[model samples]
Structures are given as structure tokens and as C-alpha cells.
Target chain A: MARFKNKNKKAPVRPVKNQPSVDHITGQKIPKSFVFSRGKLPGPLRDLELDLRKLMLPHTALKLKEKKRNKLKDFLNVAGPMGVTHFLMISNPKSIPHLRVARTPQGPTITFEIHEYALAADIARSQARPSCPKELFSNSPLIVLSGFGSGGQHLKLTTIMFQNIFPAIDINTVKLSSCRRIVLLNYNNETKLIDFRHYFIRLQPIGVSQRIRKFVQKHEVPDLRNLQDVSDFVTKVNRASTKSAVRLQEIGPRMTLRLVKIEEGLCSGAVIFSEFGKEADDAHEEEDHED
Target chain B: MAAELQTLEAAAAPASRKRKPKHKKSKNPSKRAKQKASPMAAAKPRQPSKKMKKLFRKRAREYHSDEEDDGDVEREEEPSSGDEEDFDVRDDGSGGSEGDDEEDGRGAQHGITRFVGGCRAFRVAFMKIMKKHLPDDPLGPILSAHKKLVAEKLAEDDAEHKKKGETKKEKQLAAENGHIKPANFLDAKEKFLIGVATKGVVKLFNAVSKAQNAQIGLNPSKSKDTKGVESKIVTCFFSFIHFVVLAKRRKQAFFSELQKKNTQVSNSRNDEKGNVTGWAPLCDSYMLTSSKLKDWDKMAEPAAVVGQEHESSESSDE
Candidate 1:
């Protein structure tokens, strides 16, 4: 009887708790995103996609599988269950890179032609001392959009789309500690290009002597052979009152994007605006003629 | 047989002579004129008049008899072949230069050159390919299926919510009292624009709050600052009053006592600096003699820590 009881024994099951998708304080659906490429991307663009996924962070699927045969509807179908709010799809057709940012289910999709891009590795290689801690991507980046206020309805829609793409921070509830990264989108009205830059926010403590700070932070003892007394090290140079110095260090996959088209649906719809105005209209007319 | 042959030859001779003059006349004109005449000659047999048909039949009979007269046939074929060769060479040379000129002109007009075929041919080819690949709309079925699934899911969720009376009540309460206003009334574009504006406002508010916090510290109330200032003033006034009350005698005694203590401390510090038996030299000797500090140069190597760990363990064993 004891042998039979031992054979039939099973491990106790643990209760699973579901994480809330809605913010309790604001009662708003927390925006999560999926960054994927529709078509096959080249090595550099694939790395850029990975960097973008990192930029989205915590809320985004870091390792989302995308197949060449998968269409927009496949992603849309999956998005409903996963609670994915936005889709960032990159495609390189005719050797021209295009990024489509769309809202899930229904969308006013914005298509941008990537004129130029530099991978994060390139940015890091350029710096003397590059610092990208693993914890840096634990929190999503704060977005600072500039020069998007004055524009047409398409521009306004673009501004809104960019704003909502990232999780909105409630000022009262946001922690200073978690604000570690910033994504700056600077729109050039003259050139009609948007400069996208990602940076790490660093705060240096002021009012401490360099030698003392180095010793405390790194635990490396300074050379005492040159000094007559330890007091000389501390009192040699006295700076002003202590305050935190805020600085932004570039940690990038920089992109120069030109808005090409705005569509009404998710990757398909009525063209609300287009960069190639007359040519696009002519092409549309030709298509209509053919139809 | 010789007499019959002579009769056939005599008949073919006049036809060949007459055709030779006509061919020579055509060749004497420009290449464009020859090209035009050749196509017209080829088309003539398709819809020939009665007189033209009779002439063609006579030419055909002459052609059959001329086959036996190889010399006449060769003579007739040579000129036509030579004309064709000349026409081909000219066409190629002229076409090459014309294509170059057209390319240059179009290249200047448009920054990009279309390496594909002419516009009409390209359009026709593209249409043919599209028709072959896409007989019907491929996306329609996929979109409709997705829509159906989404509708079913929504209906199921509504049914489930109705079954859960508490959840339904909570949802109703949330809809009524939630801070986030429903954006269903606005179109996609308007919603986007409003979202942008709201985000901008929130960013501005957050920036202002951060700046305010940095400037005046974390306290939000103005009354607290005023209260702090009043307390500081009261303390200063009381201190001043106390100082006035004990002014003359206490001030003199405090000054003398402070001067005595300063002199004593200076004397001790001077004595300590001058003394050879002090702890400073001992500390310097200890730091200099320490094996860890002695091997500092060697310790700076990449694998120095591993070496140190090995040495330390060996030393411990010894």
C-alpha cells in the first residue's frame, strides 16, 4: 500500500497570478508594442530592429519571430490577444528602407523613408568610453519630441502617434531613478526630416574632490608616496556646494527619417497625405484608369 | 527539248529584265523610301487587284523558270541581299546613336534613368505579371477572417461580462467615473492629434513640476516657507537679545580662553611634526615593506589577481 501511494504521488500545483495590463491610478490601458520586420532585412537593419526593440523595452517582445510569408493580418490577429497597441514594421523594397508605424486593429499608419541610419555599435565605437548597463533597458525611454507642433494634420497625427507609441508617464507617480534613457525626435521643418536619437541619462555628484570620489566609487587607493599628508589630498582643491549634474550620453541607433506617406488603415488604406504629391496622384489616376 | 527550253527562257528574259529595272529604281531611292516600298510590296499580294494578281502570277511563273537559269537567279539575289545588308548596318548605326541621344535627353530631364523597357512595354509586362500572380484579391479573405474572429471574441467577452454581475457593475462604474475620457467620438486622425496635444501638455506640466521642485525644494505649500522664515527671525531676535544681556564680561572671557586654546593646539601640532619617533615614519615604512605594495608594478598586470590569489594561498599554507 505504501509503495503504491509513493508511485501515485504528484507535486503540488502553484496558483498563477495574472499581471494587470491596465494602470490602476489612471485607469488607462497601458500601451505595449511589437517591433517586427515584414520582409527580410539586411544585417545592419536587423540590428537596428533589435536596437529599436531594446528601446521599447520591458513591454515589447524582445525575440518576436517574423516570417517572410507572414502578412499584416497575421500580426493583427496575434495583437488582439497579446494586447499589442502599436506595430513598427520595417521593410526594404527596391533597396529603399521604409518604416511603417501603425496602430493595431485600426490605424492611421505613418510611413517613413529612412534616408540614413547608424547602428548602436557604430555609435559605441565612436565614443571614448561607452557605457550601456544591462539595467538601462529595464525601463522604457522618455520621449522628447521637438519641432512637430507646427505642421499639417498629417504632422499632427504623426506627433500623436509618436507620443502614444511610448508608455505615457504620470508625473506624480514617475520615479526619478527610472528615468534613465531618453529618445529625442527632432523634426527639421526645412529639410522635412526627423532626426531620431537615443541617449542614456547620467547624473554626476558634485562638490566632491576627484581623488576622494574615485577612491569611494572604485575602491582603488590613490598613490600616497607623493603626498606629505592625507589632508593635502582632501583640502588641496575645494569646489562649490554639492548638487547633481544631469548629462545625456548618446547610446544610439540614430535614424534620419523622411515621412513619405500616411494611410488610413493598418499598412493599407486611403492615402491621406503623400510626400511625392503630384507623382503619387498621377500614379493613382493611372491605376484607376486601369481598373 | 532545246526548242521548248529556248521558248521558256525567251519568255523569262523579258520578265526578269522588267523586274530588274523596277528593283533598281527602288534601290536608287533613299533607305526610308526602300523600307516603305518593301513592306508595300509584301502587303500587295494579301489584297491584290485583278491586274496586280495577274502580274503576280506571271512573276511566279517567271520565278520557277528562272530557277533553271542559275546565272540570272544569282544576279537577281545578289543586289537584294546587298541592299538588305546595307539596310541592316545603317539601321544599327543610326539606332545606336539615336538611343544614346534619347538616353542623355531623358537622363537630364529626370535625375533617375529607367533601365527597363519603354513605358508602354513596361506597363504591359507589369499588368501581365500581376494578372498571372493575382487572379483574385488575396487580402480580402484574410481581412474578413480576422474581422470575423475579432467580432466573435468581442461578443464572447460581452457575454462573459454579463454573466459576471460584479464585473459588469465595475465596468459601468469605471465608464462613468474614469479620468480617461472615451475617444470613440473622434476619428482616427483627430484622436491622434488630441493624443499628441495631451502628451505635449503632460510633458510641459512634468517639466514645470521638475523645475519647481529643483528651485524651491520638494514642499509645495507657500505657507510653510513663511512659517520657516518667521521661526528663523524669532531665533535670531532671541539670540541677539541674549547677547546684549551678557555682552561685556562674557565676550572678554571667551576671547582670552579661545586664544589660550589656539596657542596650545598650535604648539602640540608643531611638536608632533618635529618628532622623529612619531607614527608617520612607522606607517611609511610599513607601506613600503608590505609585499603587496612592493609588487605593485607586477600586480598591475592583467592576470595579477590570479597570481595574487595563488601567492596568498601559498603564504597561508607556509
Candidate 2:
């Protein structure tokens, strides 16, 4: 009877394959597979940490290749209306059996898994429902990446990687609007090892006044309406808006691995894809419907 | 198209005269004479037709007005505005002076009539004014035009009320009858006239309500100022146009719009016109026709409903 009790206790323990480092900002674990080389990375590759640190700032502009930018545009055309906040990238073959690196018109691509998470605590608070501060939740994450090459082999490694990257998100919830997105981005070996980057794509929710302010700050225009000045202010404003949209389109597909706070969660939100050419239309579809 | 051709001829004739100076500069006297004659030849014959149409319209009005004596055009106001405005665009300009003369005649006419029913008294006072102002107007053509419109409006109202059941139809049909229905002086007639005459309805309503009180003997002699009389005249004149002129115009527009939609004007023709020749008799003819149609429809529907119920009950028993 004593021997049977000892065997039961022994069955529950899990063995560790590899340990990961903790992220300084989020205080979350960083998987070991994220590091490219054995021990320290050689030469200027060491500066990648500084580059990534700089990129993590909330207001930093995104940089992507032309082919990747086009790929990102296609993904955003479908999923941009979802108002998604966080994107989780899974590269480890252990966790995702179907993920593979494949060739496409854009270039070499990788199929991986991404789990979308919403901040339920914040959502509950916004909804005026009483909720515990520490509680965080998500719906069932979806398999969404598309590419080819050895995918299922790293299931164990990828599982740990997903655990380290994402928060302790519970899946049991009745009102989750977060959806699975199948997206493609240009791939390279360097991207496979250190794929996560932070993106700050300016979205449609940003009002015209805010955009005008951003334009003023960028061009150092003291007065918005300049009659004597050679540059037509109206044309400049339009050009600036179009440029921002192009930037957003390019930024949409570049994969990001940054950890953001998930506090508010709601099933219904205001994310109309139609362009509001008339002021009446904007009045009918209010801005902050997610609340 | 005719107006456009006349305008082009008038422009061309002037252009040729101006070109004569240029012809002189070019030393071309024969060319100048030829250009002058060509435009003048085209313009002279076309000018009289426009004038003749105006003359014809005036004669038609005088002839019709001379023939009719009935002044019950109060109910015709709603559907006449659309056509009258278009048909009398030129006449309205000259008719402005005539309207003023009619206004004075209307005030004199209102002083004599003493009807008791609040709305009836108002309608009588209005008809007296319209008659005194437009004495030549037979009031027959407009009255018939209005009857046609009322028939169509009643048809639409019936169709709409049918789905809601019989009680609504009874109430609406009761409202449609002009005689037994009590005074609703501040009604659609007042509303449509007020919209056409002035931008504000509230001011008109207040003035009219005050005048109505005075007419009803609430404060009779106290409200007899020239200002009161002028306001009353204005209301009566607008009410005449509202019921008589405006309704004719609106009926014209209604029929045109219906034709555009490919729906026939259901009340344009009446069976009672076989013996009726003049406008007043035609108005009587229309009233008889529409009332008969309404009575027939009302009687036929209930009998059919009873027959259906009896049939269904018998089938169930079998």
C-alpha cells in the first residue's frame, strides 16, 4: 500500500528540458530557442539586443521590406477590422505539428501558431462588472500561420515558448470576440530565431485633430493655414494622411512578440472597415463602441 | 423646345445686326443685308404663338369662371397647387394686381355672410372671398380637379387602413366626410396654405385662432381693427389658393408622378360625365361618382367576408 502511494506521487512530476530567461520589462519568461547561436552571438549581432530595446518603445515607427510590406497589407485587409491588440508567434516544432516553412510569390514563408488575447479584467471593469485584479483570461487560441518545413518536431519546445511569451490566460469565457488570423510574412533564418518585434501602427480610432497635431509636430508647421506659403496646407494634410495609412498597411504584417497588457475584454466593438466620406456616417457609428 | 427656338431666334437676330458693322469693315454690304434678312425672317413668325397661348389661357379662365356659380372649392385645395403653379407662371405675374383687387372684394364679401358651424362659417367666408376676388373663375374646373385628387387620396388611405381592420377605416372615412365632421379649422388646408404663404406656421395659427375666436362671437367688436381685417384677408386669400388653385396644381403633379411610376390615374375619368357639360355640373358629377364608389366598396367587402366565413364553417362541419 505504501509502494502504490509513492508511484502515484512520482507520476505527476515533469522533467525540465531547457530553462529560459525572464524578460526585464514584462517580468515574463523568454524561451531558450529565441537565442540564435550557442552561448553569445558573435560580433555586431550582439547589438541586436540594443536594437530590439529601442524598437520596444510605444511610439517607435515600424521598418519592413517591400515584399513583407505587401504581405502585411493583404493580412490587414482581412483582419484589421478585428481591433486586435496582441499577437503571439510560435516557432517551436514541439507545440505546433503543422507549422512549416514554404515558398510563395512573396518569398519564403513560415506557417506558425498565434494566440490572440484580450484583457478580461479591464473589459469587466469597463463594463462596470466586479472582477478580481489578478484574473486574466483568453479564448481558445487558433493555428493561423502558413508556410513549410520541419514544424511538428519542436512541439515540446514551442509549448514552453508559448508559455513564456503569453500570460496565464484562462480560456473559459462566454464573451470573447478575439479571432484567429491566418497571416503570412517574408521569412529568413534570422527571423526564425529572433522573430518578435513591437509594432505601433496608428489605427482608424485616432481622430482628425490628433492626426493634425501629429502632422504639425512632424513638419514643424507653426500655423495650419498658410495662405502666403508656397505649399498648399490642404494637399499636405491629405498627403500626410495617405502616408500614415501606407505606413499602417506595411506595419500590419510584420510579426511582433512584445507583451502588452490585456485588461479590457468585450465581444462587441466599433471597427467599421468602410471609409467615412460623409460626416453623417461618422455620427451614426460612434467611435468608442467597445466600451 | 418652342421657347428655346424663340430665344435662339431672338439672339440670332441681334447677332446679325451687330455683325453688320463688321460687314461694313470688311466692305461686304451684300453679305450684311443677306445675314440681316435671314434671322428676321425666322424670328417674326414664332413670336405670335407664345402670345397666342397666353391669350388662350386667359380666355379659358374667363370662359370657365363666367359659367360656374358653386363656390365649394374649400375641399379641393390639397391637390391643385402643383399644376396651378406651373400652368399660371406667366399669369401669376399679372394676376398679382388682380389678387389685390380680389382681396378688397373678399373683405366686403366676408362682412355679409353669417354661417353658424365653426368650420362651415370659415369655409363660407373663404368661398365668398374667392368669388368676389376671382368672379370670372367658374370654380368648376378646379373643383373637379380636386375631387379627382380626393378620390385617389381616399383609395390610398383605404388600402392602408384595410390591413389594420375596419375600425380604422370607419374613423378615417368619417374624417373624410366634410359635412358631419366638426370644425378642424387648423387642419391640413390651413397647414398647406401656411407653408406656401409664410415660413412660420405658429404665427399664422395664432392669428387665425384669434380671428376664429372673434368670428365665433367670443370678443366680437373688440377685435375689429384694420390690422385684424388685413390678417383675415391674407388668410382667406391664401386659403382660396390652398383649396382652389394649389389643389389643381398638386393634382397635375400627382398624376404626372403616377404616370412616371407606370400606375394609371385611377380617378381621372368618371362615368357621370355623359350629361354633365359645365364645370359646376361636373363637380356634382364627380361628388356622386366618388361617393357611389366608396359605398359600393364598403358594401361589397363585408358581404364577401361573411360569405367566406360561412363557407369555411360549412367545410369544417363536412
Candidate 3:
């Protein structure tokens, strides 16, 4: 009876250890001392009170609610001229990676970022072009001539024609760049310096895309302009920048793109005209519907 | 044949057929005939005086001149002038005077031959030869067809030389005189030009903290009213919805919006987004940016749906 009474009073259920809410994918806990229990938090995690201590320049940030009129895309575009690489939007443990390098020879160079959410985003964005006014117009060093014709048969025809030009170009001769070492933590952190011509063909101002667009309508990936276009572009670096064939990064809130660094490229004005032709046709159709 | 005979009659026989010049012999031909007979070896073999010897030599020379020139002329005129009175006759018709006319004719012929071979008449002679060989062949109408072409080629050469001779100083002077300005390269034309001329200042602090938090007003997109210089044609090239995600992070920091707000940190560390969120007056007023973030802010001029881009921007002709 005394033993039973002692069992009932057993020390008020103390947990053997803390199950610390670790990063979702990385089976490890964020160090216990990671959270700085100081000053004032932004009410709660949902309030997103930023740890200004971690920020490179706390004074440079703008508040979201106060600047609701500002589009995230335009903001990052402005940041672009600043050479931003990693625009860490949120630390949602759920965010998955688009492409995950499991392990380098030394083991996974970037592992934790490969979560379900990031993977989905990466997949979705991979299938799409990322820049506006289209990235092709910015005098890119690497140009990719993917026959993005309307249908399968159209694509096949384009590919065959492209193949003829491709061989003469010696695309294999294009030098692929290895690394984009971002020495400066700020600009390099957000911007990716790439060997744009390494993978893409530096085309004449007149190219297959222009020719295709000349005859038929080709749509641009929607809503493409960003702040990166207007700002004062400064080359913040020490050594010569390594040119990567493709660069993947987030510009604004959730905008992502697979940017092929075209050295000299421009989208087809003819394509734009064709697109207008289609638009006019669509408008007529809409008018008929209205009637 | 009859019509052609009539045409020939009407064509009027060549002037050459009407005025052939006649040849006549003088003392030289007579002397030459006598000399051929060995008459110059004086029949009387006397011991001649000095004066007599000189007179004999003169007579011998005269006799030789007539013999040589007259015989040559007669031989040339024999076959071609078989008909009577067709050739040009000296009024005297005497061997001596006619011989003088014959000498004049030979001198005229020599002058013409020499002149024809010079630069001015070389082409004329060549053309004459071509006409004789192919009288009616239009393709070989070298004399008639080549003149215009030759003149044009000469003119072009002259113009080219003149251009080559022009000095660099003249070109510079023309430029300074504003003969031509360089082509305008502005994409948006006038609007872009205006953008370069305009400027603006952006403040970061929420008015209360910095300068009494005066809310910077925005002009309506469709308003025709003049905007402040600060808000002009500003082109924003935002690649992604960067500020939105930052906002989201900021939101995450705010404990009030979460179910677990109680457990959230109390750090109200406001990382200023600098003046990034302020309104920029674009010179074009057409500068646009787009984003796919649905719940976040939309670019005013050219925002689009998740899957669809704005039609105008979709036509990115620029």
C-alpha cells in the first residue's frame, strides 16, 4: 500500500529529453543556443519579428505591411543591380529544394535546403522562364535555342532546323564554368556571376527565336520585369567572376527562375508582333462572344 | 530588188565616187624614163666646163624627180581610175602643174593617216573597221552604242576623284555646323529621355520615427495631372517577389498572427527595407514589373495571373 502510494506520487512527469523542433528534413536539432532569448520578439513567429542581429544591414530592410504597394518582384529586381544571390524569404522548415545535391565528394554541399516545398518550387520553376521583358533582352552571354514551338510536330521541325545551325556553332566547344564563388557576403549572396556563354550559344542579334517569332506568336513567361533592371549595377568582387551556364535563385517573394546566362541575346520583336496578332484575333473573338 | 535599186538610187552614190584625184607626170617622170634608157650618160663625151657640168647635174636631178614621182602616181591611178573624167583633174592638166597637185594629195593622205592613230581618233578608226565588217549587226554596233557608256563611266570616275580629294577638315566642319546629329537610342524614346533628367529622394523611417511619418502620396496611374519630380519614369527590374518573402519572414517574426504566438520570440527587431518600398516616378510611366505571388502585391501596370502574364508585357518587343 505504501509502495502504491509512492508510485502515485512519482515525481511530476518530467520529460526525459526535449524533442527540439529541428529542421524538418535534417534529422538534427538547431543548437539549443540558436534562439537568442533577448530584447523583444515580434510578438510571435507568425509576426515574423526578424533577428536584426543576423542581418548584414538592419537599416536597409523595409517593412512589408507599411509597403504593401511595393511588389516583391520589383524589390528584388532593385536588389539585382546590388548583386544579391540568396534572398532568404522564410525559414519554413517545410520549404523543399528544387535540385538537391545529396553529397559532394566531401558530402552534401547543400543538403538541408532540399525539403518537399523547395523541391516542388524548383520543379515548377524549372519548366518555366524566369525573367521579364524576358531575360533574353538583357544582353545575356549564353543563349539557349530551345525550339519552343507550339506543338510536338512544330517542335520537331524546329529541332531539326536548329540541329543544322547547332553543329556549325560547335556548341560542344562552349566552355562550362565551374563555380561562382561569392566573396562579398552581400551582393554575391543574392546575385550569381555566371559564365553565360559556357552553355548557351552567343547568337547574332538575329537568331532562330527571332525568326520563329517573326512568323508566329510566341508568348513570354508572364509578368517578367523586376527591380534589378533599374538600379545602379556595381561589380562587387575580387577575382574574375566564374560564368555558370545556368543560375537558379529567388528574386522577390517567391519568384524563381532557371536563368541561362546569355552573353548576347534579344527576344524577337517579330515574335512580339505575332503575339499582338494573336491578341487581336483573341480580341475579335471576345467581341463576337459579347455580341 | 526593184525597190532596193530605187533605194540605192535615192541613197545617192558615195561622195568618194564623185571626186577621185588624178595623177600626172612632170620632169621627174620624164627624167626617170630617160635615165632608164641610159640617157643621163650625156650622148657627147666632151671635156665639159665647170658651168656646163653643174648644169648637167641639175638637169639630171630634175629628170630623175619626174621619172620617179610621175610613174608611181600613174601606176596607182591606172586600175581604180579606168573610167574617164571621174577623177579630180588639175585645171592645167600639164604634167608639171598636175604633178604639184599630186604631191599635195599625197601630203593630205599622210596627215590623215597619222592623225587617225592618235588617242582622239583611235576609237573612231576602230569603229570604222567594225562597221565595215559587220554593217548591220546591232550587237556589234560598237561606234554607236559605246559612246553613252563611255561618257557615263568617265563621269563616275571624275566624281570618285573629287570625293577622294575632299579634306578631313571639311567633314569636321560639317559636323560642327550640325549637319547631322547621332541617332537617338532611347528605347522608350521621349519618356526614357525624360527619365534621365528626373530625380527623387526616398526616406526609410515610418514618418513617426524619422520625419513625422508623413505618408508619401501616390499619383493615380490614369491621372493626367503632373506628378512630383520625385515620382517620374522609374523602371524597376525586380526579378522575384523578394520583398514579399522578406515580409513573410517579418510576418513569421510577428507572434500575433500565429496559433503558437505565445511561444514566439518577443523581438520586435524591425529590419528597415531602406527606401526600397517608396514610390519612384518613372519617366516612361510605362516601366513595369511582374510577380506570381498571388496574395502579395501586384505590379500596377503589367501584373499577371499565376499562369498568365499581362498581355502587353507578354509582347515584350523591347
Global lDDT scores for all candidate models: 0.60, 0.30, 0.27
Chain A TM-scores, per candidate, are: 0.84, 0.24, 0.17
Which of 1 and 3 is ahead in lDDT? 1
| RMSD in order of candidates | 27.3, 47.6, 38.0
- lDDT per residue, candidate 1, B217-311, as tens digits? 76554433233433543455466457556887698668755764754423332224325454232354644554333253353343433444555
Q: Which stretches of candidate 2 lie over 4 Å from their true place?
A: A1-41, A49-163, A166-219, A222-291, B1-318
Model 1 chain A, poorest ten-residue lDDT window? Answer: A282-291
Global fold similarity of model 3 (TM-score): 0.14
For every prediction, compared with the true complex, DockQ reads 0.02, 0.00, 0.01
TM-score of chain B of 1: 0.13
Cα TM-score per model: 0.45, 0.16, 0.14
Q: What are the per-residue Cα lDDT tens digits for candidate 3 across B1-318? A: 234334333222221222233221224566433423432141122233566446544543453465656535544543233121211232233343222222323322322111111212333443455467556643344444456786677779888888866755554443223111212232352232222211100011111112211222343232211121112211111322455578888886573346224423211211111123422222133123311112234343333322224444555533
Please give, for residues B123-204, the per-residue lDDT of candidate 2 as tens digits.
3444465576433632233433256777677778888778678776764544222112112233563233223322222232
Q: Sort every candidate by TM-score, greatest first.
A: 1, 2, 3
Tens-digit lDDT track of model 3 for A1-291: 354557657756656343332423444322111111112112222122132112211112323232434433453454444322223222222111111111111211111121111121222244344332223222212112321333333233323322221112112221112111110111011332111111111111122233222222232222324335322221112222211112222211111222211111011011211112566535433422221
Chain A alone, model 2, TM-score?
Answer: 0.24
Q: True contacts preserved, each candidate?
A: 0.00, 0.00, 0.00
